[model samples]
Target: MILIADSGSTKTDWCVVGNSGKVLSISTQGINPLVQSENEVERVLRAELMPAMTYISDITDIRFYGAGCRDEMITVLERLLRKVFPAAVNVCVYSDLLAVARALCGKNEGIACILGTGANSCLYDGEHITANTPALGYILGDEGSGAVLGKLFVNALFKGRLSDKVRTAFEAETQLTMPVIINKVYRQPMPNRFLASLSLFIGRHIDEPDLHRLVVDNFRSFLVRNIRPYCRPDLPVNAIGSMAYHYRECLEEAARAEGMRIGTVMKSPMEGLVRYHSDI
Candidate 1:
């Protein structure tokens, strides 16, 4: 049996596959070693994850792919998982970006991207990443991500780029004036999450020409700034995340404009991950 987990800032999806080919699914709050302490992560593993594994002892392998699982965080997560699943002999922790590459590209060489709360992209050579353009988070980069889209939309709303009617509707619906938005973004915690949450409003108005252009332009920036650095124009750009899935039309348009093509736009990596592991 093997256990696999794909984690992001918001949630984690756990899959348990038995030797008999049976699969069980479970959901738990996300675990980010970069943000949460070891005790906090261990608490979730024991309280939420452990209870879901009825055949825990049968598991001999564990793979954890998640956001913030890098450098020292990898060791931290490996220690916790080892403590939680002591029966497992093989344990590996990897970045969520690698997970996207593996899930979308499989064993084929291509460009893989993640457009979620934040943005990330890499050139994958089937089994490993050859190059990456740093995301630099929502503030410095993350062009096509939900957080950046919301940032652009909100900026347009307040800076007179959007129509008064649209602004009025947004303010009325979200009850977020410039003051509230300022507080939420500048003073409050998890500003990226707060900004990403506003993408729902952008999605609702995406059909409008201005809104559509905004989304397309955002994706264009992502391609120009992030993917272009790889200089692999011949490779089809594949992506995994809510931002890529929900706004696929806009993403497709941007790709066409950049003389690129879209491939394997998956909303989540769990299903593909399961398939990849099953095949292995």
Candidate 2:
């Protein structure tokens, strides 16, 4: 059996493939190693993954592609998985970007971009990554992501640039006062994630022209700052993420304006990863 996982800031998707290349089960959980502590990661793995894999006792191999699995975090996750799947002979843990690359580009060469709570891009040539643009998190960078859009929205709202309807909708959804929002941003932690949460409101009003421009401008900035540098003017780019998939038209428009072509926009990589791994 082969176990593959794709994890992001919000959730983790798991796929178990049998010897015959048939997927036995799929599961999900919140296991972002960047945001959660070692104990927290172990808790979720025990509560979520172990239960899901109850029927399969003899696992032979496991591969985890996850967010926040960098540096020391990667070592910790590897140790934890090793303890959990003792019967498995091989286990590998890697960054979630691998899942994006494998799912989007597979054995072909292409540009693979991720636009989620954060943004990242890589140039892939079949088996390896040729180049990668730095992802500077939500505060400094993360151009075309939910956090970036949220930051833009908050700035506009506080600066009195947003319309009455937008203000009302935002207030209604979050039920947070301006002072509270400001305090959370200035005083609390994970402000980027908090801001990114506000994109849900923007997503709700995508049909509204003013709201649409906000999304487009942020996404455009993301492409220009992050993706454009790595990609040639004519390179076809494939995107993976909820924000990119949901606003593909705006993304395509932004790419065209920059003389680039948009290829595939996948909402979730789990299914595609499953297919890709099954083939392997």
lDDT of 1 by residue, 21-98 (tens): 548999999999988999999999999988887989888999899989987789889989999888999999999989
lDDT of each: 0.91, 0.82
Query: What are the models' TM-scores?
Result: 0.96, 0.88
Residue pairs with backbone overlap in model 2: none
Q: Ten-residue segment with the worst summed lDDT in candidate 1?
A: 15-24
Worst lDDT 10-window in candidate 2? 19-28
lDDT of 2 by residue, 97-194 (tens): 87788888778888899987778889888767788989888878889998888888888887888889888887888798889988888999888788
lDDT of 2 at 204: 82
TM-score of 2: 0.88
